[model samples]
Target: MAVEFMHPDGLLQQSDYAPVAVGTGSRLMLLAGQAGVTPDFKPAAPDLAGQVHAALRNIIIGVRGAGGDVGDLARLTFYIVDWVPEKWDEVLAGIARAQQAEGLPAPTPPITIIGVQALFTPDFVVEIEATAVLD
Candidate 1:
């Protein structure tokens, strides 16, 4: 892997993800925001947790489609609608489940979560975009 994640001294080292990611791969993949909607254009899951899980899984699918894996991911940006601090645990849990199902280790990519008022569809609670580098 040409991507390295670092948590320098004096930086917060929470297990959720690394705060910094340096990638030196020759190929880069930029994925569009993946929503919770399924292939049939229907909601994959109705609840926030479910949408979060589906969106994460979709990100994995995108990475793999680009001939990359989770470890190749350098960054992730999550856009959430009506996001609430209280639901963070649920979101984390959904991410964990998606990672496990994909046979991926804990993500080390730099992650950013943004709260927004809405999305393309009224049912979409979350959307995620991923950037990956392939060696």
Candidate 2:
């Protein structure tokens, strides 16, 4: 599969992501917003970093279950409650750890992060949704 990123003139060039991503593939996968929760509906981790790791793990699980690999992911949408800009370092670190554990490639998908007041529950801090493609 081939993915292309384009930034039109007059638009700010984002180093982390492109304004548009054009992907060529035969199949598309849209995953639900996965929270950092266990099968028993309990918080998977007590802190933000841990929760982020757990959520990333869930994303890998979902993608693989759909017969897609982490590299197939084309986009990511993250909804965070009471988000702090400084927390990104920890969040990214957690993601890195999860990817390493799962033997997944370093994620380079276009991502959108939204800061919200709350989620489905008080214990939930972050929710991650994904879009993937498969040939």
Candidate 3:
């Protein structure tokens, strides 16, 4: 499997995506947007960080179910409701923990975080979407 990271700069890329991700894989899994909702469809947490962690966990499970691993993740997009400057550090730390749990390297896949007014659910604070290549 070949993994290519586009726009290697540390500063977040402002484009809709980092760069075109090409993979010679027969199976491609497109995971649905995962929120903090749990197995029982209950909000896993009330805070942003907790919700972020839970969402990432759910995403990993989805990837595994599709015969893929975190390493196969090619792109990640995040939608955050009510983003705040004071919470930046906490958010980054939570992301680090999530990547660690997946046994993935630091500065994981190309990511985009957008602040929105609200999500489909009132209790949801964050949602994560991932695209993976299962080669």
Top candidate on lDDT is 1
lDDT of 1 at 123: 87
Error of 3 at 90 (Å): 2.7
TM-score of model number 1? 0.92
Question: Residues 27-79, candidate 2, lDDT per residue (tens digit)?
Answer: 88889999988978899998887887788779889988988777777888889
Q: What lDDT does the true structure give each of the candidates?
A: 0.83, 0.79, 0.75
Q: Which ten residues in a row have the lowest lDDT in candidate 1?
A: 99-108
Pairs in clash, predicted candidate 3? none
> Per-residue lDDT for 25-130 in model 1, tens only?
9998999999977988788988877887788788888888888877888898989898788878878877877777765457547888899999998988889898
Looking at model 1, residue 77 earns an lDDT score of: 92
Any idea what lDDT model 2 has? 0.79
Q: Please state the error at residue 18 of candidate 2 in Å.
A: 6.8
Model 3 whole-model lDDT (C-alpha atoms): 0.75
Which regions of candidate 1 deviate over 4 angstroms?
none
The CA-based lDDT of model 1 is what? 0.83
Error of 3 at 80 (Å): 0.5
| Local accuracy of candidate 3 as per-residue lDDT tens digits, 85-125 | 68666567657668677554355677778888999888998
Q: Which portions of model 2 miss their true places by more than 4 Å?
A: 1-21
Clashes of 2: 0
